[model samples]
Target: MSAPSSVPLVVHVIDQLGIGGLEVVLVNLINNTPTDRYRHAIICLRGATDFKNRITVPGVSIHTLGRRPGKDFSVFRRMWSVLRKLRPAIVHSHNLPTIDMCVPAKLAGVRRLVHSEHGWDISEERGSSRKYNMMRKVLSPLVDRYVPVSKDIETWLRTGVGLPASKVLHIYNGVDTDFFHPAEGNLIPLPAPGFDLANRVVFGTVGRMQTVKDQVNLAKAFVELSRLRPDLMERARLAMIGDGDLKAECESVIAAAGLTDKTWLPGARNDVAELLRGLNVYVLPSISEGISISILEAMSCGLPVAATRVGGNPELVLEGETGLLMPSRDPVALAEALATYMDQPELMQKHGAAGRQRIEQSFSVTSMVNGYLGQYDQLLGRQHP
Candidate 1:
């Protein structure tokens, strides 16, 4: 459906359209929301990447501010001008980078303001910094509601960041179970040339290779698996999707360990569902997280998971059930977890099956879209039909 100006417009503000969990959540929310009920627009604070093409719903416009580096005060002026032209009914911003613009949104006569903390900034602690919390407190009056993607973040905003308790609402990021189901007998070939998963247990993950994501750690863990038990490592192969600043570093780690032939880094691909299907197990070795869309998507694809115990990872991965968790920055723990799953094929299958059931029961797209719709309806005082 195309955008209809007759309905309210929600301007989703973010730092960039990077290929990450938050971007996936934004695309899912916009595509799933009924276009007749609310028209949507995206405002990138700095710029947008090719990831913007994922927005399938038509008539949704995207604007960029061309922000300069290190305290570009003029970006605010540019954003203010954009807000004036859009005159959005609800300026829904994501994360701290877009929080400053809520003031500009309110000044430009926006009706309601909503902000969601998808995850912590690269530098910012989890709502614990005194200086940053002070800024959020000062601008709290301008925001109508604060939607955190996890209960952990909800606590940080209320008790740590000191936002109003009543205004803080928690929402879980969801996956399309129908779209990301278990693979049939026929699995697609890998994107990388001559890299086959035949007779090997392929443990993989899909995310931006950044410091916070700690994909490099996962690569190092794959090497450690070789050292701990070469027999198991011979049967194991690693495939990490997505690309970023740390991609080169991850490559170096795998190459140095002489596992380049056994590992596949396909950079970034749009067909994440197909890629997930080809994997026997999913891994999320992030240093931090907030209701990761990748984990949900992987689980929906019926892949057993091995994720780090940080941020919202614990909340998502049920220990001894759906997936196993390791402490962040510890490659040994991750390597051990991978070995355990590889040692027991039946256990891996059991976990993968349970993960799919969990996604259907608790993390379906309908639940996520409904949660946001309910919040929007109540905030705007519009009754839901």
Candidate 2:
């Protein structure tokens, strides 16, 4: 069912437009989606609009409600006003907080409502609260389609959140292979100078240095690995890219472990694809995920990975084939996994090649963009026709 509007507007709602896998995917979605048929706009609830530069599509308006922290209902009034003004053909919200905008959207007479779950944050880590789950179930009728980025989340939606199986559409985040493919010869300079990339086995991970990401754990593991294998110190280095509140904590851990010189924390980077090329191995030290775009980008760049077994990481990282997976929050287990790659450098090439092949076979950006477009078309046809 496709809507008849010449260019139907789609309003995307989220808590913040900051750095994260979810925000990255949204940028990719907007950039790749056909512009002639659809117009897109963003509404940020908490107003972290630092990543707006990522949006390349022209005329895509960004709005911030400036909602105060701690259960702000006044944001809904602002959202309602925005809905009335835009009159979007579709209201698509991401994550948990923005889902409430569906209430105002429905009241504003927007028929097409779509919601996506990008996995839990530190707060609702174990699962959604009883009150939150009940609220979701109550608002379930307002959502025309529910897109969960992984099968794990699809199950959570179906059983835990009480969403019907038919309503949940599982879509894995995709990577732009053209932009993130393997480096030719250090096209991007390393942030940490004096380290020899040709000789050193650079192990790196890119993400916001937040509690849920558990970058401190990666720092600890790297320090332990350094202690366990002093001989490999000349050949191994660690890079923790991206920045957040927990960055100081990561620095403290590295310093305490006597690894301040061994590790490089370069804060947030714009040239991630080039940065991915500079590393021999990629790591995802997240406590939770919904098919991480960073892991996919690393694979696309032909870099072998060492990630936790939590969330959708197992779905992406095949044990011993593409990369090794260890238990979450355990520095010892993480160190052991990193040690395997450090010792068996030959495995790095094999797994790195396999990872790129995997990306080409199933996780290309085209496939992900098409999946979202198909859902949009379905929602439009259902609502307008």
Candidate 3:
């Protein structure tokens, strides 16, 4: 299954290509890799959304299996057929659902099989599912390498899923600092409608409006903060970007709280870098996370963060230095964390500078791309450790 030296083909498998941290990293990896050394393709087990357009690299093939609603066993057969034709030198699957293709990939004669665990859903947030663990055990021998986006996920692989520590590689997700850097004054248009760039101090978070993201909690906290601090309400605003199944519910929470005007709920957006530049404080209230790319982007944009102390958030945000961390799902705690910035606006500037410095020192996109390339070369026997 060894590919020719001219250009090795690598196929990435994922549940879907949509607005997410993992998808953003995948796009960056492909766009940054040299075209002369590697060619790329993608296989979406379910289907790909318009987010597929983000891949600016030319000559990359995209395919979809169109999985059905429940128990889509046929996708494995389809994967086998596709892999037989593509004959990729390496087949890399992402997250839980995409891990099913590893066996089919090995059977189809792929040169190497790699799997990545980015984050988890509510049901199996800790990767402790017995069924999934059994499945991983059955497929473990076939996988050449395991890539976890964060150390938390790597620990789950070793302790919860029974993976050998030697087989797991921890790669921190990186941000494109150059693209997400702070803007000059009020140059970028404010994302929300009512906020004036000159007077308003905007606090924001970007991600899908899902239950795990807890945008409803953010709405509740924003309302409480507005009620408690009437003096700051005139100039304070909350912007919740990115849409999901919970968008309507989150809007309902805001409207019910009688603070619809104080909050802005923009559906899925593409101009995140511009929006991040205009934010005064960044907040991530997710009940669960796995090294959020939005957090890194916000930090890179020179904004202080107030994120829930869950998953790999603590790894990115140093408490009281880059941003404040609080318990998840508690509106009071979230409001208080946001209120700290509203109280002493100077801390935002101080911590924001520290956050930008942190990103420059540790989470540059070049570091992430090189980490993946090193792993690929190691598994391909092109590099000796």
Candidate 4:
């Protein structure tokens, strides 16, 4: 079922609606955005996960094009057909995976085209590849606007991609404070059957277990923390939630360190909010990021954060304020940061409280939805009332 043609449709194109930070933002936007304002739909170039059920809106559908890896020109033709049929007022693509969809969207007559850059440029780590930049420049005319989730990404668009300032804007990803609120924590029986984080200064992270996210390094850091200060390890526990290709590798590292009993690596989970509540400190070890929604959600749940100083992380995490920052891919540095929290419970609580306050002041779901909807309004030639 679809919304009546009387309502404007906004079609979002992405790689897949799997369990990731980018997907979390998309779900939040769709669930919070009022249906009366504009109808929404998703076109997964690959396929979606059960996470799609998290969407609460009506008349929204997730269509998969079964994209073949390496090269699949058919995806554009399929996208073209879908957009022509949907007749969306706006065609919004997410990150590099879906940016090329704008061409099909334009050919299908979508008047408004949006592309949100949820991570660093794919041209390279430094985003200095001339070929990829040229490709992006050639496609710039097709995109009406680019939404970067962090100021860092916005800068990249302006400087690295040579995009005009007028066409680029930064919008911070928001958290559901009401849903991710602090709780007494149920780590004893929540995360697993026999696992218990009771009385332990739990440091946890909730994201895909992949190379980019680099959860293995977090495991190594936890091991390093234990080796450096056995007393802190006795009072600390590590929980790595979510599952991906690197999950087995992380488990292997934990097993090799002989600390499997002290850590909980539960694969994919639906009780993320509850798990976050159980944590005293949240850690993000990604090599790169864009205002991590996990950090925002953890902060909303009154948990201090220890994140890699990369991308929009620095923007959201004020060093010595809401959280601590460390160099990415360095387990030793990450370990030192975690030790500070484990040794000082008072610091964790203070920083956690400050983090929650920050969310209330700047990163509420209302503000994020409004920021995006304002862009949609501008592209549609309407005023933001």
Question: TM-score for model 1?
Answer: 0.96
* Global Cα lDDT for candidate 2: 0.88
Those runs of model 2 whose alpha carbons end farther than 4 Å from true positions after fitting are: 1-5, 185-189, 382-385
Evaluate all candidate structures by whole-model CA lDDT and list the values in order: 0.88, 0.88, 0.88, 0.87
Candidate 3 per-residue lDDT, tens place, 7-73, comes to: 7788999988999998999999999987766788999988899998988988899999999988988
**Which of the two, 1 or 4, has more TM-score?**
1
TM-score of each: 0.96, 0.95, 0.96, 0.95
On a 0 to 100 scale, what is the lDDT of residue 202 in model 4? Answer: 78
- In model 1, the Cα lDDT at residue 192 comes to 63
TM-score of 4: 0.95
In candidate 3, stretches whose alpha carbon ends up further than 4 angstroms from where it belongs are 1-5, 187-191
Model 4 segments more than 4 A misplaced: 1-3, 121-123, 126-128, 184-198
Among residues 3 or more apart in sequence or in different chains, the pairs in candidate 3 whose N, CA or C atoms overlap within 3 Å are: none
Q: What is every candidate's alpha-carbon RMSD to the true fold?
A: 1.7, 2.4, 2.2, 2.2
- Candidate 2 versus the native: TM-score? 0.95
Backbone clashes in model 2, listed as residue pairs: 1-381, 2-381
